[model samples]
Target: MLTTGNDTVLSKRATKTANTDEFLLTQFEKAEANLFHAKDNPEGIVNMGTAVNRVMEVELIERLTKPDALRFEQRYMHYFNNSGLLELRQAVADTLTRHLAPDNPVSPDNLAIMNGAGSCLDALAYTLCDPGDVVLTPTPVYTRIFTDIEERGQVDVMPIVCKAVPDNAEESFRLYKETVEDKILETQSAGRRVRALILVNPNNPLGDIYPPGLLLDIMKICAKYAIHFISNELYSLSIFDEDANFQSVLSFKDIPDPERTHFIWSMSKDFALAGFRTGVIHTCSSSVMKCLGKIALYQCTPSLIQHASATLLSDKAWCDDFYLKINRQRLRDRYSCCLARFRGAGITVRKAKAGLFIWFDLGPYLRSRTKEDEMDLFQEILKRGVYIVPGTQLYCEEPGWFRASFAVSEVELEEGLKRIQQVVEERKQKGQVSWSTY
Candidate 1:
């Protein structure tokens, strides 16, 4: 067996290094090899698997224009700062405070900037968790969360499995405080130290937001155990629902454990700047801030990108009035259109109020209630020229559920949906609809 407990056969040379590295390299290469390449398959395949804002190019271009954008200073080439540019940190602090933490303002001193949220999570996991320590999260989550923390941190992720019951109307996968506590206790009893609890508010893949009350309850549990609480609010501003009532952990006036709480945000999702790779880490823990200051040296964003991002965030009028408002409206419109397309095809999707994707069940389209059947369905969709992520990839407890990002152009979204409809209709006609096994 490999060190990471994988069943892969290893050579003598492979035994010299960590097996987890090889495992992750293989998984990443596989994704690159099998997944649709947008440029190459522009007309051939519809990529709905990646969670990104491929839409709204006009707004993005407008924001990064010459007159408004920042120019890099000659001094930026030197190594005066590696944690982050102070100006950029302040800008991020001010922007996040204005939107997500008005009551409890975030201080620039408490912020650590990095290349991306994935790097921040990796650094955080390394800082907080010892080898073999467990971190708990609810699934199905953004699949990268697993690789981000586990590959380098070597921490075990124990899923707080939320089942999808027959009564799906009540949102069976919703996380509860009691369930979180139970999972923590269960992990502890099995001789593992639960180091932290990570919550992705305005959750990815699911696109659901947790209420403030539930967030507080979960925070209290983490407090009781004296463990860290890492809240990835990358999608906080992406909420399209007028009534979703999204709350940031920074907004909470009274935190259960101030020192153990940390929050992460990024320009990737809300600002459609994934390529820019700007991520922020806000912590109440001074120790964490200090540790991050050290770790950030290895994961710092480019000085020029940091300057440009700072200029963008510092534009209060543009950020609040034009960019954010228009982005949210666009997301709402696209998500609504996508949902309508699914419903029009007699498919049921979990009603989403935030984020960029839809979670829908394809159990009826599966040949059997197994991972093999799920992959078969996934492959069939790919064969139909549409690419979507199967639930199995996201560590979903149940099979036949898939996440399809609607953050593509209307042309792409419609093409993908049409492919799905054609595939389903043909399968049904061929008597392949097998919900009987479900």
Candidate 2:
């Protein structure tokens, strides 16, 4: 009922939105196609390139063993029927109590395990977003957030533009709150119902580490508006910089209504088990979660992922170690690499606070060429051996923006930057960057 049909819910104010091959799945798809023939070519930096394999090299391998986890691990027993073991959800509650809140403890009854944060998004969207609802969010959000929201044409979208926070990732939490309120008011005046607000900690494209004060601002705004506050904390534990990491919105026990705010997080990013594909959605609201359950009835998580997720989720010690590893692996130095190179070339980029990505401004480069021509130039970058996510692909009017991940090793990261620099030089020389594509 919440499906968007084929109509994409962009923005009501903007007539033209910029989308380039860089932002879409083109580079990844292209590299994948290139791989079909070169099957023997050991997976190289030609893909998401940010070192998803970092987890593979983790020293903890001896602890997991070669059998139970990879092949014969019995964690697969819980499958689709796992409403989620009480103990696993309790682990999340325990983490919240230990790290964010002590007064209010979350119980298993408040949590449910889904396929991934994306699944939780679908369930929440289905539950709260009816036909023609509007999802209020910020720009340059995770690309899937848009596709998932727009997938069900029921809700139109309103993107509140966030300003660059320079070096403070946690500082943007306050910025996001203030801007979202402004955008929500704008839409309310236009006669559109603002159904919910979605947030990604450390952000998806920008990787901004939002501070605690900012999160309180968001919690206050959401509580005041009576709108559903959907927090995607999947990357919450990936805070590479400690000073930048703050308590999550879910940490606020005084939340006006426990049920009004919902949380989505997983062991994927933190545990380096993305391939494991199971995640948890927790909320104190019984009614809202009840509605979410109906949607889950349609597409349950695979049994195997559920079992593995439980193994890691039940152990409290594993939770601490997981967060520690992610925080340690999160590299802020990548900011220095891309910015030094790009800014030196006159390209403006935003500062990345946490997580593995950095978003670059390309408006200066998009001044020439048609949409298709721009795609061609983007494809050329793939030939250079470094792949990136384009801004337009993330659904924003801004041109000349792309994302790079730094989860790779120091060597691979340096090499990727060199390739990107080489390609930037080629584009600048040929005057190939295009802006008219939107």
Best prediction by lDDT = 1
Q: Against the hidden reference, what TM-scores do the models get? A: 0.92, 0.79
- The digit string of per-residue lDDT tens for model 1 on 379-428 reads 88887777788887888878888889888887788788888889889988
lDDT of each: 0.84, 0.63
Error of 2 at 132 (Å): 1.2
